[model samples]
Target: MIPDMTIGQLTTEASSRWGEIWDPRATRMTILLLCPRKERKMMELHGDMIEHGQPVMAVFHRPRAEAHLLEEQGFDPRAASFQFVNIATADMGPWMQQLVNNEGWLRSSIALNPTPFSVGLPSQRPFEAVQTLCFRHPSLPALEQYFLPYPAESLPGKCFVSLPRRAAAEMARQQAEVLGVGRLEKPQPPAPEPAPEPQPAPVAEAPSESQETEASEAEEPASQTPPEDTAEPPAEEHVSVPLPPTAKPDPAPAQAETPVPLPPTPGEASTESPAEDAPGDGELSGSENIDLPEVVEEAEEISELEVELRAFFQELIDAGVEPSAFMDDPRWEDISERAVAEGLETWPILLQMTAMG
Candidate 1:
């Protein structure tokens, strides 16, 4: 049968087991055991005794661990001498239970009856497990409270610590930042850049001089797009890529047959909702083609009229128009020219006409 040693007897055995020859007065009564995994061996503690005024002890490492033990001056590799008999209660039940329950902790062949107090002995966390189990009360409230902030599985060697969600998110974000822009998805190659637009086949030089004159006038509208609507001018280093030819131009807008005269600023806004007037799912009927050009002309006419209309309305409000004279015989053509020169709209005249009739 294995000899059962009290915490005090372990002190004598620890010293004798090491074969330490010391003066009887110099033999340390207390010591720490330094073991790794299951290995052990011994050495004497003399410095702390001579220097710190503390009682010293004989220490050892498992013989099997002899080759692996460190021989540093102040380091104790084992606890071969310790008189733990004076320690009131030393139960290692909780520690053994914790180790068994926490499978990932270091392999611990727990003592059946803990007559030893190995407080200073080292393990993964020094003596935390042993001390915790020995001192921890068995009451449910005590157990629950003790385990609240830290679960046993979360103990270093224990693998059951589920990572907290916030910590996980932060870790993931940090990893993404480390990966940088290069490793990320490469923008799907941008649909092959659709191949630069075919430049209108350079307009087959017009056959006749008369046709050329018509061509010149037609060419003016192509360049007429407002500067604001086009893409911004490219900076020096970058070349401006013209839109690809694959995409077709938007179709002409539909409108009434006669040119719809511009509405006056003083007039209430047109009730038509822009969306209601927007084309829905299908192509316009063939009959609608006749009104297309007229619609385009009216649009061009509206653009020039917008600024004037706003200005003239302001003018008239300052110096009122004669209500009855507004309908005097004057063609819109003459009104158009003067309005063009003055940058005024037909709005003031329209308002007067409305007031007269």
Candidate 2:
């Protein structure tokens, strides 16, 4: 039904209404589908973005060749576990108009936990939760993953996956916990086999005490030794002990339970690159967007400026505004332009952040 709806998706032409998860952001209001890769069908959904009066985007697992396609369309696309991406950003207003007007569109975001359980939906009603869960479109693997053993009870028909942010945090926490537990359970070598053959001096001291008592008792002639020597080695202490206790817990420092890293935003490949501390680790990839210039100190300064400027502009980008509109506004452009003349080059960064079709 949204396929024919307009920006509010609730214009007078719309005869019916579907409930929406209350969100403050005016831009991203639409039903989300969690689905398998079905290019043709999803293109139809993109069509519906215009019809329904919502920006169209998708989350799917696939080859991801469509990344730049969405990127060019001004969508925020993200890669999850090398398989999935949250694609489509330009789903509102003129872009939507062009979609309905001329017709079409395209990609960002954190990784979601890849399991049956969703940590973020506990507060939601079962029906809402089902809709949220079922919103993922049915693909072969996703279908096989969710429906095989068949959680048939969970089908929130027609509802969207408006999973709350806490749910995302919970998902992150749960993922962190599993990874933590796995690292704790990993088999490790017994600690440096204790300076081989070095005598355990403590047991030696216990025997010395026992012998001195015997010697003093030998001097006491018979009385002390008779009652004491008769007592056995503390009944051999048959008390049970769990295996790991007292076994020097693998001397290696516990591997920290790091939550799966969140996916990168535009121009932020750190999440996608190798660990920062990876030794001899210079370049993560040949992507020119991240390449460094030759002059070490000077290039470093430019990189710093670039990073700062990009972040400052991300807010406008996320708002789905055009940089040219901001420039024409008179308030921001002069300051931005003057700053650019000072060698800041902030406008291009702003353009990349905002400019949409």
Candidate 3:
């Protein structure tokens, strides 16, 4: 039977054996607990971590055989209690490792173990995927420690650990879809209202005095009275009478005619002065002064002495190398001067300098 040890004694012995493994400055620890299919045990472990003042993030991996049992228990993957990950066909080690790395290790220590599952035979070895993950982390517990009673029993094949809350939630979402279990529906945002269309302005109507005058003159002839009838004697019996000469009607005074204005032809200017014809602030006009080039532009022109050198500098920046490194180099002055003359060639000098990194 295993002997019980005092808490203080345990701490002392732990410090002596694994002191270097845990950084004292770390305020939190990201713990990976495997095969924690039951909710109660997970809660217990979480409380234990909290008591130690370790900010814990846990991922519970359930086997395919126990999935129905979880569903029957009314297990909600979206619950805030703990994170969930599916492990039916996919390996859990690499997935967990990726999560831990992405979440980062700067603030916490990391620990991996399997629990609450039955142990396999002593000859059994952990999964290679788990071992690989552990090997990459310098602060992780020794592989031999994982072969003990608890981890061996729960995580039989591998010993990879730790997860972030966001990563765990994402994994749970993906696993729900894979298992044919539908996800919870998130409420969608309402669409924006459409803009109102502009209406056309009303047009004004002109007066119709010309039409009214034409209509009145047309009816005047038809409305006139007939002349009275009179009979006269034959020309032989008629007497001729001399009449006084009639004065010619005075000529009507000539009226002046108003002149209609006409649009000017091309190549002719209107009567308006040149000042009036000049463009106002609202009108587009050409700028008189030319702006100087940007600093980068000037630098590029100076560097143009070298062929393909500018492109190399651009590629270096794109590849995440510091631009200042090249600029600050002692060779830059000579190279810049030579580039103006020789145009820096790609082959002999540039390749040699680049390989120095």
**lDDT tens digits, residues 44-141, model 1?**
21121122221222222122222122232232324221111111121123223442364322331211121122322233221232222211112101
lDDT of 2: 0.39
Clashes of each: 17, 20, 8
Our model 2 lands, by Cα RMSD against the true structure, at 51.3
Clashing pairs in 3: 119-153, 126-157, 127-157, 127-158, 305-339, 305-343, 306-343, 306-344
Candidate 1 ranges beyond 4 A from true positions: 1-97, 100-173, 179-186, 192-357
Candidate 2: where are CA atoms >4 Å away? 1-40, 43-91, 94-98, 104-156, 162-190, 198-357
The TM-score, computed over Cα atoms with residue i paired to residue i, of candidate 2 is 0.16
Candidate 3 lDDT tens digits, 45-72: 4332222221122333333432333344
Give the per-residue lDDT digits (tens) of candidate 2, residues 1-357: 223322332322222321242223443423333323334354334543333323232322331333443345443344211221122233334323452334222121222222223433332232222222223321211321211111122222221222224434455566778788433566877787556677666643346778888889788866645564555565555888677656556688789898997867856676545565464343433343575778756544555556656765675566766665655544465556656667776656665655542
lDDT of each prediction vs. the true structure? 0.34, 0.39, 0.41
Q: Distance from true position, residue 300, model 1, in Å?
A: 99
User: What TM-scores do the predictions have?
Assistant: 0.16, 0.16, 0.14
